[model samples]
Target chain A: MENLLDKKQSIIESALELVHANGFHGCPVSQVAKNAGVAAGTIYTYFENKEDLIVGIYDYVAEKITSYIAERDDDSLEFENRFFNYWRNFTEFYEQHPAIHGFYDQFLNSPFNSEKVQNRPNMWHEWAHMFFQSGMDEGAIRATNPVILSILVNTNITSTVRIKKNFKTKLAKTNVNLDEISQLIWAGIKTA
Target chain B: MENLLDKKQSIIESALELVHANGFHGCPVSQVAKNAGVAAGTIYTYFENKEDLIVGIYDYVAEKITSYIAERDDDSLEFENRFFNYWRNFTEFYEQHPAIHGFYDQFLNSPFNSEKVQNRPNMWHEWAHMFFQSGMDEGAIRATNPVILSILVNTNITSTVRIKKNFKTKLAKTNVNLDEISQLIWAGIKTA
Candidate 1:
């Protein structure tokens, strides 16, 4: 059982690397197997197919990202502090593991993103919604749909990370202060 | 000369319609010609190939969107009103012509997005930047990098339009006030 799990884990890691480097169509199951150092058939033993492999990678990356943020989260803190921690953790994870973000970008654009993919309830999102609800209750966040507020705040974080990644030199040259960004986003969503 | 321009315009319009419906790969030159009611060779006369056609479509859409916003723009207006007008124009354009937005979405994800495409030196962007600079100079906007502020505002517009298009039911269900969304975004970037 341990050996089976190891093989599955290796296959997933290999998929993430290959899919990140090359897109979904670029990294076929054959390439994933070769990179994983297992027989091409071995990939099938783990994932049903290439699409399945990609889905598995998505789940893995999502969990890694959410768990990292969750660990940094402290329920006892003020909503603002907790949100900052979440944002910081998310940005740091993307900064350190760009491959995960790369795969995620590709996955979002890929054909695999169906209703099933879109509506797949996520624990992280639930946690975020709960946090936003509490903020709304406390009259700290906008009374507008909590979902929209969360999306706006989330976009700020993602946008910051994207600029930091894609325009590293330009971002550095501009001397953008990351800390100020979260505050700006908060200003946008907080109640008047 | 007039006839040639009309044929070319028809081909370009047909390409946009088909490509937006079926994606770049799904709509070949032959199909565009068929939709345009022109000869297959006629498409070649106007565009060198499929990629060129897609580029032409993008340029056409960009001009349409920018011109629409520019026509409504008044330099005499306050920056806040001007920015709101820009936001409303952009969203209305996308909402009315979702196929254009669809094609744009696919084009962005396609391999055709080269540095040349990325740095096309859009006049619309220059106008936006100048407006942002003025806002910053006048102390109406946040002192943060104007680019970041512009991106945040632009993302809010795009995000709203996307949700409005893709989740019309949910959007209506939630009674999301589109006007309020721009205000929320502006709140993020506006100074005291």
Candidate 2:
């Protein structure tokens, strides 16, 4: 059973790397299987089809991110400290796994992310909602819609990561301090 | 000359629709030519190759967005009103042209957005910088990196649009007020 799980995990990782390099249509199931060092039939054993494999990649990334953040999360910490911790953990996860960003950038816009797919329960979004809701409950954050707050904060992190990755040299030359993004978001959402 | 320009525009429009519907790998130059009602050879007259056509789409969308916002911009208004106006105009543009959102989501992540490609000057970014800088000049907004501000503001608009489009029914059911996003951003960036 453990060996079977490992093979499934390996397939997910391989598919992510290939899809990141080449868009969905470019990375067919055969290519994914070759890259995973598994028989094409093995892929079907794990996923229903190519579309299933793509959705599996999203689930894999989402779980990885949520687990990383959840491990670092200290509910006992002050709300502001917790906020920054979440920000740092989220950014570091993407920086370490740059392919995840690429995958999301393509996946979210692709046809695979249909209404049915998006409406499916997502772990990462649920984690974000609970985090923001806790802050509001404690009167540390503004008493606005948690969904909106999550969107505002999460988008900032993802966009920052995207820009930093895309314009590494250009950003280094300029005084574009990324920390200010967190500070601004904190200021905007914190209870005045 | 005008007729020739119209042909070029039609080709671009058709390609955008095709690319949005089908990812870059799925949309071939031949299909684009057919959709545009032009000869396959005619696409070459305006664009050098598939790669050139993809870049042309980016340029086309950028120009359309910047021009739309620019035409609605009223510099004479107070900075805050100008800020909201920019936000409203930007959101409305995407809402009207949902395909632009789809194109960006794919293009920005695809191999097409190479460093050499991204390094190309973009009118939209420049306009955003100037707009934010003007706010700082008037002592209305915080004195932070304009690039960061642009990322934060623009990402919020795009994300909100994406969510609204993707989760139309869910958003309507929840208290996910979209306007709160702009207000929160303003609260975060405006001078205390």
Candidate 3:
């Protein structure tokens, strides 16, 4: 029984590693199984097919990312601190495993869509919508439809992370300030 | 010589149709030549190879998009109307040809690097930046870096178009009044 659970976790971790190294389409099931130190049949026992494996990796990554994002809880901290914390957490996780950044980059597009991908909505997004609402109510953000605002903000974060990961130099050429960029972004949405 | 130019233009148009229908990588030279209704050798006459052909198409698309963006001189109109006119032109052109949009969508992340693609910067970007800067200077837009702000604004527009193209039915659920959405985006960037 313990073996079954271990194997299940192993499969997900292996899929993440493999998919991140090779792109979503480039990685294959056989390679994942081999890297996991399990037989190809063992992978089949855990996942139905390649699509299932990829989606499972996405779910696992999403869950892991959300946990990191939601972990920052300082009610006393200004919305700015909490907000920057989210970006910091986001950048830190991907920084730790640059490959995971690659994984997210290659698979997040809808071109790689599947039923599991469709159904397992990004848990982090829900928390973000709540954060935007709180910002609005707290007069930290403007009163407007939070949907577009949240989507646009998150897209920028994704864009920043992507651009940062791709930057080859040590120079401070990247545009966004880790701390101040948050203020600049909210400056538009802040009270009149 | 004029007849040669017509044939070359026809070949490029045909290549665009095929590459957009398939993908830059998925389509083959033989297929492009066949689709262009020219002998395989005739393709070599105008372009060096597949890479050259792809870059040529990209340049043509960029010129067309940027030229359209550059020609908007409706300074007599209010900011709102001016913004809408620009959006209308951009989106209409984007909608006219899925292939052009596809080219941008596919390459936005990792464009095929060529001397031509590298050297050929988007002139439309300059005009758009100046437009945004003008708005900022007139106290119409929030004081942010004009270039980055334009990138952010363009990100939303292109991403929305990509979403609509990719998930036709799902986006309908967003209840997005595009005009309102466009206004909202402009409003977010604009000074109150």
Candidate 4:
């Protein structure tokens, strides 16, 4: 059973890397199975079909990323520290996993996303909502819809991360200051 | 010549609508031609193939959206009014054309975008950079890289517009005030 679980996870990671590099349609199950060094039939034993395999990868990756973000939370810290820390942690995580970051944007824009979003259990969003709610209650953040606030903060971080990825070498050479971006985002969401 | 131009444009528009509805892979060149009421041969005259058609639709749509935003700009107005006006106009435009908005997210996430971004002329970004530069010079906007400022503001608008599209009816019933969201973004980049 442990070996079976390992095979399943390896299949998911292989598929994720392929999908990141070649896109959804371009990456086939056979290629994913081969990349994982498992027989093509083995994938069927785990996932129902190609659609199932793709969706499985989505859920698996989401869980992993959400766990990373959730684990960064420090309940002992104040709201601002907790919030910015999570944001910084998320940026670092995605920056480290650039392929996953690329796959994420692809998955978000895919048609399958809406279906997954409607049906999937999203702890990440829940955690974010709770954090925003706590901040509002503490009078640290504005009294806006938690969802809106979450989206704003998340977008800014992701956008900055994306910009960093797009021109990392040039940006490094130029010494572009991304530190200010976080402060700007915090300014947007913080209470007056 | 005039007739040819109309036919070419109609074909592009049809391709956009179909691609927006069904996605790039789901919508084939034949289907686009069928939807546009044009012969498959006609598409070849306007575009090299399916790949070209999809990329062409991206450039066309970008031009239209940029024109809408650019048209909203009043040179005489102060930076704040100009910024808000462009935001409101962009929101209204994308709200009315949700399909185009959906297609836009897809296009942005697609590999084709990076290729296009590298090779294509971006009048919109240039215009936005100029606007931010003027605002900075006027002491109305914070001193930062104009590209960073543009990305921050643009990301917020698109994120809000995405949320609005995702849950319009429920959000409408809840009376979620997105107007304040705009003010928050403005506050982030504005200088007192």
lDDT at B59 for candidate 3? Answer: 71
Structural RMSD, model 2: 3.1
Over A4-123, each residue of candidate 4 has an lDDT whose tens digit, in order, gives: 789999999899899888787767878998899988999999998887887787778777778898887887788999888988898998899877787877877677675545456677
- Reference-based TM-score of each model: 0.83, 0.86, 0.67, 0.91
Question: What's the interface RMS deviation of candidate 1?
Answer: 3.4
Q: Identify the candidate with maximal TM-score.
A: 4
DockQ of each: 0.34, 0.46, 0.17, 0.48
Give candidate 1 regions above 4 Å deviation: A39-41, A109-111, A137-139, A175-178, B1-53, B109-111, B137-139, B175-178
DockQ rank, highest first? 4, 2, 1, 3
TM (chain A), candidate 1: 0.88
- In model 1, how large is the Cα lDDT of residue B101? 76
Candidate 2: residue A130 Cα off by (Å) = 3.1
- Deviation from native of the Cα of residue B127 in model 3, angstroms: 7.9
Docking class of 1: acceptable
- What residue pairs are clashing in model 3? none
Q: Clashes in candidate 3: how many?
A: 0
Per-residue CA lDDT of candidate 3, range A15-113, in tens? Answer: 877766545544577877777888888888888887677777777777787777778656578776677776677778778867667676656543454
Q: Where does candidate 3 chain B have its weakest 10-residue lDDT segment?
A: B107-116
RMSDs, each prediction?
A: 3.4, 3.1, 5.6, 2.5
Worst 10 residues of 2 chain B by lDDT: B169-178
Instruction: Give one digit per residue, the lDDT tens place, for model 1 in B113-177.
Output: 55577687876667677778888787787676667666666766766776666667655565346
Candidate 3 DockQ vs. native: 0.17
